[model samples]
Target: MITRPRIAAAFAAATLIALTGCGANTGSSTNAAADDFPKKGKSIELIVAFGSGGAVDTASRLVAPILEEELGTNVEVVNKPGAGGQIGYTALASAKPDGYTIGATGSPSVVVSPLDPARGATYTRDSFQPLGRHVVDPAVIAVQPDSPYQTLKELIEAAKANPKSMTASTTGLQTGEHFALAQIQEATGAEFAPVHFAEGDAAAAAAFLGKHVNVLVGDVSGVTDLIKQGKARVLGVMSSERAPSLPDIPTFKESGYEVEASTARGFSAPAGLPDAVAEKLEAAIKTAIEDPTVVKKMEELGLQTSYLSGADYEQYWAGQEAAYKKVMPLVQKKD
Candidate 1:
């Protein structure tokens, strides 16, 4: 016995009120869901862009367990080595941005690959979202123990006397080692014969040991064993400060060479990750990098600890890219 118009008005009012209540509930639920997204028991994959036993791979492995402990979840490390880390990096870039798939990328991958178009690389530093930087390992110029060039000055003099006669083995053609070597050469105005090795530090060490190359430009970890065994002698470290592990060795700056370079290893996620998820992942990485276990491992490997959060890391990366752009062209212009 209600009039049709009154009933219709009543229905409209009820519908509007219900819709308003539902909208409020939806917003609250969304905020709650976001707060609970990375719940306990979720798994995170830590991708390494190198083979096992290498510096980046080893560092990632050391950090994974501690990250798992911190996040209260299973953190797994996977190796995807090829194309000077471009292949693994590409894989990381293509992954979902759910904070589940993270990658440990470093110097040459972050700085050099993007600049070297001859390598056919696609992703640049901007392609991935920075999580945090964990470690910095300096490069060193090493020579066989029995080599005639005992000091960095002696080697520079020799290179100046005979351009391209002083063969120097590096990780790859346009790798960090190569960049370091180029920087040193530019600083000193010396020419060194380039011996490119595909297998990285190990092969570079082998080339020096086998008398195939006169010098080897590599990381401290790469030449530590050889130097300890009297198989190689470090000429100069490619850093402003002397390495703590080899306190007796002099830095390039100390040796009168104006050069400073180190390999920075850090974590990153695929591009377009949700801001909330990126925050969670960056927090977890910061925790992982500061963990005692991670610190001990990095110190044992002769790596310096320097952590940078997502935005800060990105800013630092931009500076690095600019530096690479300036330096890479010089390297390419040389013989």
Candidate 2:
């Protein structure tokens, strides 16, 4: 007989079974969605871990439209600049592992931020899945057009004679410019008081142009306009070879200083992103980076196109991490 108690128990059992089935279906649906990434209408967010109008943001914006066309979805470039890219890196790492949220990752800020416990960065090298690399912007040292230092050698000698007398602009503490400064100090015993602009290259360049700083330690992409307009004079490029964009400027190597540093920009998704979704995103990025229009645009901005696929991109990051770690002590801010 189906008594009241028996009926209640039967109902409970049915409810449990239904809930279990719903759970299984939920997981299956999630897997299916990941397998069929983009889903036709959902837009992808491309986080730029720097200020707008800066090199990273500029690159992200340049590629967003191409990525949108290639992936058949909107690619939104969101700037989350602050704390020398710590805020954006944390945001990118904390995002859901779904491929919808990817970020423009650059070194050595992205690599060295987590390495230093002081930065308290929540994300490490493993927090991201590199999709593809875009460019390698070589660093440059520039002074006012009327500055006394005409050659890199003259600037180094003056800085060596009066350590920390000259003020140089860097994007922020422990950024690419700071690292370049450290490399110069370590190699040549020249020290310039670093003025940090956490807002990114634009701010740093502005400070230099406004005469707030004596020298500008920035990337080729950041100062390309100034260099072309003759508003600033480049002392040297911190690259093995003379940057094609600044072919007239001499490299640090040419000046007998062994310092080569450049910032590599790329796209990366949150770690644990689904394999199918990651593959799709990687392929889309590869296509966008290789587009002729994109290539020309990057070159016009003084950014050299250096494309690397997902696996190779990750390896590049790994190598950068190792290389930066060795020099971390040299560039870390002293308490």
Candidate 3:
């Protein structure tokens, strides 16, 4: 479970479900919303919470053309790109619930934002309708091509030996990578200096590749280009199992550190969308994301397609909301 929405505080999550029980079931309501959607020429807006060129933005751009072909309309990718994904998510939360203003963002914005009040996110789990999950990109520990650390164990031991001397770059403060790094610190008793900047797909990887940062704590997809260019090497992927994109890369667990964290990127619209419209949007998303060509492109970008549509996507996300809270205490909020 990598990304999700409409599931918030424990008690509030329960009450939110009670209030919006229309989304609890399957099929019957979907048919109603599917009828008369788009009318053939509607222009739909797709917002990407992170900056252009990042994984989130890349996913949206890749799907936009195919989505247009499927829906018979224009699908524009709008990048808000700030506040560690809060800005675009808020835009989606505040957008009209007419099925034309859906947005995509990573999981931490959905799962961990509520725990950090400093991020000032306006949308909670109840604020939007989930369209579908697009990608399950696990984080990886990547070091410079010529770095001393050749294995996950070596990196952990080195960090433990030199405390703050080793630095790990992330996309932003308190972001998913930051939390993942914290989990690594807690699990291995190895302290690392967390260095973050926006647009991790570029900046974080650049920092690590240029030797400005010692390590990159970013998604596998985010560092694909770097790895492909031989600018970096992955020490381990942060997933329960090895990622298909990089089958040879060991998981943190395999390296004797029980850590698994990933960003699940997906689409969502403002709450209260008609069942027919939601269903229609979800169908278009699934078709676009799972297309063979699209799947090939994702693989090239080092991403794996993991589509969960409508109610099924919502159900899975609701569970992750609870899972994220357990790691919240370890994260240090940034103002």
Candidate 4:
């Protein structure tokens, strides 16, 4: 028999008891107990770590309506931007476990925050109860339309030719995009100065468009408009596969670089929530993810669907955190 991770086993046990309604002894008696698992008449608040119009915000907005319909309750999406998503995640961790407040969190928050010293965040994968994973946003390397470098090779050559002159724009130091760029630099032995922007993706895009930066690294959602309008051209995507929205772009691995990173969006309620409440929230998220409207919205935003319920989501996060830990030390700290 294949051995599973300790957390996976734990999650499987919990899920079997909660979701499948399977007990050691099953009969009409178990059905009565299983009927109590579905929670009714509850309101859930979903906190989006980034500002409005971001990938996370857009995803939450698209899924919240469908979730509202599925749960037969009110679901609200609130924007809480700060510390590259730690502020909101910290807040979510501290909320009451009544299952009323959930947060839509992705990379940097789930994987990178724990590795950063400045954030001062203490919670781990055990802090919150995972509802489910929703989408995966792949990182992309893009440059201003008028830039001399048209391809990843050309950009690498330019950076290799002049180490610090060619600067790349990213949200902040040690962020997901920053890490992706660092991976590129390490893989190719090319050096480019990093430009930090305050407003995340929008600021990074603006810097590139204004000729303040030669390159910008971020998720496809943030730069989709720029790519569509010829303001920016994606050099490569940092994913195992090419994004459907940008079919012409090649993956970093495919382009002879071994860098692959993807940010995942998921829902989580505060820890210690009742199993019934968690089940209800999970079911709602499942419904939202399967909804046709959500599907279309995700496709338009260049997001990949990935659903993981409760224990599975938590275990997946643990693996992500471990990977980030290995990659964090390789990132060059910015002053």
Candidate 5:
């Protein structure tokens, strides 16, 4: 019995009310996602760009439990290793910027990957939001126990004489070790044919131990156990000074080479992450990295704990990117 004009007006009112309610609900849900982020029962994924048993993977695993404790949520350490950390880094960059997914980052690998056109990296340094930095492990050059190269000088001399006859193992292309080799070659004319192990230091170490590569160009933490067990003979440590853990080993400078390189590892989330979520993540990471227990564990593994807050970490990476750009042409393959 309703009039046609009255029915139309009622329908319009109903439609307006429904639309308003939907808009309000959407805003509330979004605010809730930011305010109550990392809600209970929700888990965070911590991605490691390297394979298991590598330095990056080890540090991420060690931090995951403490991060979980601080965030009141589950933290899962996921390894997505491949293509010299490109696969994992790509995954991290492409993930939603919800702060629920973060990954371990290292340089000069991460800093230089996107710089190289040949790498075809999808993400640049701006693609990630630096949460915090953890450690800086100095590079080391080692040979098997029975190798004839007794000192770094001997190794350099032999490499210069043989050019590409000597094969060296690197974690991957554009990694710290590769850069170190390029520096050495450019400075001293020593040529070493590098064998890139895209997996990480774990695989590179295995290749050196199995005699597949004549020399191992790796980091101190990656080869500390090998040196202790007398399975590898370290010729030089690529640091400004001798490593405290390896007091007996000398720096490359002391051995008459000016090469020095180290890899710094840290955590980062995809860019555009909510400020609230990012702040919480950065604070939690700072706590975990500064934890005494975590420090002791990292020391035992020969990884030096060097914590840098989110802002400082970003600046540091920017500086590294600038410095490495000058040397990129030196490392490029020559036809």
Candidate 6:
């Protein structure tokens, strides 16, 4: 019914329309996906399992502005504290795969809850898809600069000689720092009066500085502040080797005890996030972590910026799971 000239003109007009309208086409799933992703103008929820003001919360807030710039929407952090982070991880697992809901979580603990049934978890490693891992904060055993114990050896010997005579503070019960404490007991046969604080590392630092506790097990990121202020002195690191940031500080291994531990922080979205959308989020996170400003901020926060994307992040978590499985027994509260 139509001549060749008319058909050619119609084809040219359609081509022009498609180019002008962002390549949208009826029944074109690719075009639909590209447009629908992030659903522009919609906000993304960032979940922090612990209460406000902790390392995870601070890291999430820093990344939020960067994500907002990249994703073109507000990134809101929701604090849902319960059961030592099980509540938040459960919410992340149960969230729809639409890529709107995301969470910042720590390794060893993230891996801990799912494997340790005592945590009463509803999620597994497969629950949420990891976007990327950004930070690895090694743990440290610190004391007040003017404490009687000059070295880790002196402190352990004293604690070993008299159980509960010396006190130790941890961020929480069965947390990574707590686990490190357990390892100290296992390795050195020391008995310390373990104190729990919901305020996490900052509280750990404060307790030791205020002399509320004789010793504090805290993340390198958290303890660095105290060290810089000349309030606390690190006795030993829990990691296998001295942290590059603290070259002079020796690890438990280097100090003659075997304890390798650190906290890894990263983001993840609900399971089954469409690959396209997940990739977008991953790229944004990677870019943010690599930014000079972000890098400087992380250094100031005492966090080491280590970006591990997708499979690399998963592999790291799995490795932590294996290591923690072996170390979990050390942390049991002896009920």
**Tens digits of lDDT, candidate 1, 14-101:** 9999999999999787667556656777788888877677778778888888677666789889887765677788888889877789
The prediction achieving the highest lDDT against the true structure is 5
lDDT per residue (tens digit) for residues 1-335 in model 4:
55578779888889877755645446555444444433466567898766777777888899888887776778889887766677788889889877678998786556677676755777766788888888778888888776777788888888888887878887766677778777877789888888876345666777788888878888977778777788888999988888889999988888788988667778888888766667777888898887887888788777768787878888888888887787787664646
Cα lDDT of model 5 by residue, 272-291, tens digit: 98778898999999999999
**TM-score on alpha carbons, each prediction:** 0.85, 0.91, 0.86, 0.83, 0.91, 0.85
After TM-score superposition, the amount by which residue 30's alpha carbon in candidate 3 deviates from its true location, in angstroms, is: 15
Tens-digit lDDT track for model 3 on 242-293?
A: 9887889999998888998888888889999987787778888999999998
Q: Candidate 2: lDDT of 188?
A: 97
Relative to the true structure, how large is the alpha-carbon lDDT of every model? Answer: 0.80, 0.90, 0.82, 0.78, 0.92, 0.81
- Model 2 is weakest, by summed lDDT over 10 consecutive residues, at 30-39
- Clashing pairs counted in every model: 0, 0, 8, 0, 0, 0
Count: clashes, candidate 1: 0
Overall local distance difference test of candidate 6: 0.81
Clashing pairs in 1: none
Checking candidate 4 for backbone clashes, the offending pairs are none
Q: Write one digit per residue (lDDT tens) for candidate 2, span 150-181.
A: 89999999999999999999888789999999
Clashing pairs in 5: none
